[model samples]
Target chain A: MSATVYIPREATALSLGAQSVARALAEEAARRQDAVQIVRTGSRGLFWLEPMLEVATSAARVAYGPVQAADVAGLFEAGFLTGGKHRLNLGPVESIPYLKNQERLTCGRLGVIDPVNLDDYRAHGGYAGLTNALAMEPAAIVKAVTDSGLRGRGGAAFPTGIKWKTVHDAPGAKKYIVCNADEGDSGTFSDRLLMEGDPFCLIEGMTIAGLAVGATSGYVYLRCEYPHAQDTMTQAIATAYAAGYLGADVLGSGRAFELQLRMGAGAYICGEETSLLESLEGRRGQIRFKPPLPALKGLFGCPTVVNNVISFASVPIILERGAQFYKDYGMGRSRGSLPIQLAGNIARGGLVERAFGVTLRELLYDYGGGTRSGRPIRAVQVGGPLGAYWPESKFDTPVDYEAFAGGGGMLGHGGIVVFDDTVDMAAQARYAMEFCAIESCGKCTPCRIGSTRGVEVIDRLVAGDRTAMQQTLLRDLCDTMLNGSLCALGGLTPYPVLSALDYFPEDFSTPAALQAAKR
Target chain B: MSERKRVTIPIRVEPGTDLPAAERTAVLEAVNQNRALEGSLLPILHAIQDRLGWIPPRTLPLIAYELNLTRAEVHGVVTFYHYFRQHPPGKQVIYLCRAEACQAVGAVSLEAHAKRALGIDFHGTSGDGRYTLEPVYCLGNCASGPSLMIDRELYGRMTPERFDDLIAADAAGATSAAATSAGATRA
Candidate 1:
């Protein structure tokens, strides 16, 4: 009989030699005159331990981690197919501490099933939400979500149900439900994982949104950087259309909803809702003025509901388990589970989906296992590029949206990038400004010209010209960018730059000056 | 200090003149295939670039004509996006993630090594037309830092040594050449 072997088809897995490992497993099996069936599944999000391989045992799925192509022969020789012991064996998949501790609501099906298999999805609790949603009134669905305390997971912390309610109440010839999958954040992969791993969750979520908002049309504005995600999502969408989870009659509910996958050409600003709307309309991704919120008039002047992948993906479970099940998990105003990504120079970096209020210290030490270099951690940048650089003193702060905002940091998209003691905060601050300059839509002068000037000021400061006049100028520039800019791309850039300057002022001083002052 | 907002190459061409005859047909075919899509300009531009590796100057007017927009409107849209190339790339395009995640794991050093080895900076192709280097903000492989993508294939946890070896292997045809050929055939 042939043994079943599982490998991840996810992006990070493929990037880390999963393809070659799969090939080696097959070739080695054939050469030994033994048969092996390879099952491609989504990643479990223990990314540093990829391409993690699993074998189907009768009792459980036995896991082996960080496997290279070179480990194939020795593994077979050790009788590893039947869950026999090997040096690299990570035991059962569920027993792993990092994955075991996670409270996976939206991400429950990730890495647990064959990604593109709709039957496999149904075998799991795939469309239970839609099934229940089809029986309920649309207003009740909106009220359930609103009562569940589900806010937009895409950094802004807006109430998801309120946006849906706005779209639900608005009258238009056509309404839209747009999933902002343009995840351009530097240290975030939660959106990509869900899209590639459990795409049906997003589809079901979108269907529920369409039903709630009376929108018949939908679009997923995905970034061009994620071609692997595009391939997986496209396949999943085709599967969905075939299975009646999408298209004119969703799950035979006698209602209509249609979805189209749209590609965004490499503009980070498109992650912003208004700019994304502009790009979806085939125009330049420039920031639009407010008073016409996207909920009121969006997507070619129609009432559109734009939500992030995580936000949309969270909807299915909210609908299935009802409101209070989700509301009971989180803390304070920020309710429901938060999927936090740990990246950069961390010892064990991956996605950690937990209820809100988990502290930074716990995420960094208990889960992340400290820096990958085994050095003292100096700084950690919470949120994406526009988030604040928190110091060691602030490690105990809980990962609540309001808590972070109160502490001069915002948990933007829940991505945390760590840096060791060797990192230069001054250079990081300059890079933040430079990143703003590169991705800015050039609509407002504050972000367009202010970022360039900010970079020059940081350069001058670190180049030993740290005069008070220059420092004041830098502060004033950040203030202008914060208050005067049109969008968050311009408005929130000071979060990183000023946070760096405030947290690590020594980094802004030249090495010579530092040496002299220390003496 | 400039945003690299517009294409550096001045675009001026008649609809039926100075364009490669075969690619023009391919361009028109791409436009027609996507003309019915909502906000189809981006889809058309992507199709042309995917088939030909870059959008030709003359093809812009053709796309505009098919989409019922002006040549300048089409031109503005194409230049606004970073993915659509105005000039042809080399046989193999290398995208190195220079974002903060990759930087934390030694992307800067690897970037310098790649530049020195290739004898060209970012957005510059080698004299042999074998390689073109582009800086990608993020490929979302954050845990395994210093990610590099050669054509459509992605590699992670890259070091200067590994980068050198991989590109050498690419030059020697050890890696898949399908993406390269599909992009290079009409360029």
Candidate 2:
């Protein structure tokens, strides 16, 4: 093993020339006779200062960067590798305000370790949760998860513990734990970051689930678009098997659990658990009827606990820190920290993990530092494309499921996409319907047909259909889709559409004068 | 040239192409592994695509035979997803984001210009076997919209000027045609 330096430069970091900086460091190290290995790790979510470099030493690793290749020799001469003072004065990385106050549970080990290093993973509290669970009865493990108050982070906000408990209690000869890594939401890549940045967290999370639910197998249904994440996870799983964390009788425990990754073909609807389940089973990704939920009859007609990447990723922390420790942070029933992705027209657009109920106003103005365009933030699209568009007046809406629902929006995946004053809400509303139309699996009439028709209606409305009759028809279609659709795809597509109509009525007012030409 | 009409490539199975016996078994096992999960046919098709870059025209019969469906039924699943391609790809895959966010940031103009420059539409492989163009939606790095992913490397804030420079750099870096072709087929 040689003295190595790791750069926490994700794709976001690469966009800022982190690769060149890494190469520069490698060259400088090479000139010194001693070899230096530059391992590219995931971003620390402090995306503002990417190309963040950490140099290994006997003590704590010293960090230096957002440094360019141009300054490599100067950095080396200044003894920056040993954490000497420099112009970048980030001052002992742990002291950085954005990172210091963060309640990092899911992202605890994100940028600290080499993504593929199984040994590094073990050194940093990686498999402790699995180790703890391996010592207990499966039912006891399920109870611990239940008490943690961890909800699904993949939009739905379903209780993770209850879902697992149901699978544990359900009568089935075979059971499964599926990680819904098909994170297709436009403004979200937390799942991708976790899988690529820290693959072991997901492995530990899945292993714990397998032990709790009496399941012998787990599958991570990753998106095809994230080929890097898929490859990272595949390598990690192989390493884990070699280390005895996966595949038959894990860690000397009598429990048998095998983990696999199933790649999704880039369909947005497959993010829906049932569709994901269907896709995993070699079928078209159409939503299934509830009632006979996956808890009862899932993969191969056995009880399966399906959850988003973050939900399971939160497991180790819950187990290690105990239920009350995990639950103590949040306000009200929305217990625990959420990995909120602040994206779109925002200055500091990256992951902001905070306790639940950190109101949108604070998150937008205080944390995000307002619009990146220097224009007034006109609107914010919280959640994915299907989420509602909330204007400035609703910014006070607390970042919790219930509060968001009361404000005519759902806290789908905690992905807050800000939009500046230059945005046309009418156009945004149309795109929402258009997105739904494109992604609907055509399994049900309401989603497949309603989405296409919704696009047409939105177009008509945009075309200056100034009559009250047209507005009424649009509202009625929204209501019908919300009530009749089988899944969130069709049901929530109207949220953005109707929210736009409600908040920005001026967008609907195309005068009859220029309407003909505009249309 | 006039705007090229989009062709929905039909799925077919081919028997030729020097696939080893182990690889053939691996492909069949991939189909079986996915089918055993949820009894869904689409996942199985996606699994095949994941392992093999594009759905080989010959694998449809193998998939069809396993799933107890005709060739057409299997074909439908492969074509439905924009991620799936019927033809074998070229050397370097250039995936340009054409979603709403990217379009809002001028991806539309960039995409059109790129296609014109390369003489290929989305899913079209350049005649020189250097690059294949693909259209993707949002890549989740929207703060720096108008992005492209070239062989697992995400390039953001992509402008026409930078795009030209990237192509030139890639041409200069080409050590071998065979290696470049392999890189183009994936990502």
Candidate 3:
């Protein structure tokens, strides 16, 4: 009998040499005439242990990893095919502390099943939510989502149920469900992970949204950067259509729900809901003024339920288990598990899914195991580029939306990028302004002009010219961009700048001090 | 830097210069495949770029004419997007991640090393027309910092040595193709 060996085909794992490892395994098996079958699955989110190969034993799946192609010959020589002893062997993947400790509601099936196989997905409890949602009334479905306390996982923290109910009640003959898969935020890959690892969950979630609202059509506005994800999703969509999970009638319910995938051409602003809608309509991605919410007037001038990829992907679980069962996991107003991506300069950087109350200190030290460079951790940036640079002092803040917001930070896409003591806060601040300047949709002046000026001001400060005055001017410029901008692109650029100035004033002042001392 | 502010600076095309017959026919076919869909402009632009190497200056008018849109509108979109190349690209394109996550773990140094090695800045093609360097905001491989992409294949945890090897391999492939073509010419 042939034993099945699991190798991750996800982008991150592939980048870290999973493809070469898979090839080596195949070649070695053929050379030895060994009966071994290789199956490509998604990463278990333990990125540091990538090329993490698994062998299915009668009892459990044995694991080995951070494996390279060069190590394959040695692994085979050590009789690793039937889970023999090797230096890389991590017995029974479920026993690994990094993955075992956390709650994985949304990502339960990630890295577990073959992403494109319909039967594998169903066996692991994939469409149970859609099945349950199919039996309920639209209002009941909306009420269930609301009762579960699910909010937009895309940083906004807006209640998902309320958004659905608005679209459900809105008087529109045609409505649309648009999944915001344009995850342009740096250090964030939960959306990409979900889309690539288990695309059926996203499809099921969107279908539930389509049924909840009267929307007959859905679109996933995915960014072009994710070519692998695009291929995976496209294949998954085709599979769903073949299985009658999509197209003219979903699960033979006699209701039509059509889904299409559209690619965005390298625009960061399009991650915003309105801008995404504009890009979907085949126009430049520029932020539109709010007041007429997308739930009221959206894509093609119809009510639209524009939710993030994670938000939609989280829906299946809410329906599969009752709302109360899911809601019981989280703290405060923030309900359910938040998939936090630990990235950049961290020892064990990967996806960590836990209930909302997990502290930054716990996530950084416990799960992350400090900086990869082994340097003293100085600061961490929660969220993306637009999020604040949190000093060590603020590490106690919980992962909840309100807790983060109260501490002058955001849980934007729940991406945390750690920086060691070697980091220069001033340069990071300058980068924040520079990023805003580059990606700003030219529609708003404060974002357009203010960001450019902010870059110049930071440059002047860095060059040791009139530091005190520039610091004050930088704050004022941030205020203007904060209050006058149309969207978060302009409004949130100040978070990093102001936080840098406030948290690490010494770095900004050192240049001036050095200049004065030299004089 | 001053040139960056302009939304649409019209490309200078010599008078009476048209796209080659085969390329023109391919563009028309690509446009026809998507013209019936609502908001077909972006997809049409993508198709043209896919069919041809890049969106030619002469083809914008052709696209506008077929899609019932103005030439200015088509020009605006091509310029607005960073992905759409204004000119034909080299044999391979490399997109380096320049976002904050990458920078946190040595992307800045990688960018400098890549620029020095390639002998071209961002958006510049190599002198031998073998490579084009571009900057992408993020590639969603932030867990492994200092990520880059050649064509569509992503590479991460890159060092200067590894980068040099990758470029060398690509150059070797280009040389072999050139050699084959030269042999074909002799035959």
Which docking category, incorrect, acceptable, medium or high, applies to candidate 2? Answer: acceptable
B1-187: candidate 3 lDDT, tens digit per residue: 4566657887754321376886688678887898777677778788777767688877777777777778898898888778888888888889999988788788889999999999999999999998899999999999898898865677888888888978877666753321111012111
RMSD after CA superposition, every candidate: 5.7, 6.8, 6.3
| Cα lDDT of model 3 by residue, A1-519, tens digit | 588999987888888888778878999999988899898887888999987999998878889998998999998898787888999999999889999999999998888889988899999999999999999999999999999999999989899999999999999899999999999999999999898889999999999999999898999999989987887898899999999999988989988789988888898999999999988887888878887999999998899999999999999989998899889988899999999999889999999999999999999999999988899889999989899999998999999999999999999899999888989999899999999998998999999999999999998877767777888899999999999999999999999999998999888867565685477
List TM-scores of chain B, every candidate. Answer: 0.85, 0.73, 0.82
Model 1 per-residue lDDT tens digits across residues A386-434: 9999899999999899999999999989999999998999889999999
How is the predicted docking of candidate 1 categorized under the CAPRI scheme? acceptable
lDDT of 2 by residue, B1-187 (tens): 9999999996544532345564476567776676655455756666666566678766777667777777787777777667788887878788897665465455767998899888999889999988899887667666566778876677766789878878877789842321211112234
Q: What is the lDDT of residue B161 in candidate 1?
A: 93
Q: A309-365 in candidate 2: lDDT tens per residue?
A: 999999998888788899887877788989888777777667778999888988887
Error of 3 at A269 (Å): 0.5
Off by over 4 Å in 1: A512-519, B1-14, B177-187
Error of 2 at B148 (Å): 1.5
Q: Ranking by TM-score, best first? A: 1, 3, 2
> DockQ (Cα-based) per candidate?
0.38, 0.25, 0.32
- The 10-residue segment of model 2 chain A with minimum total lDDT is A510-519
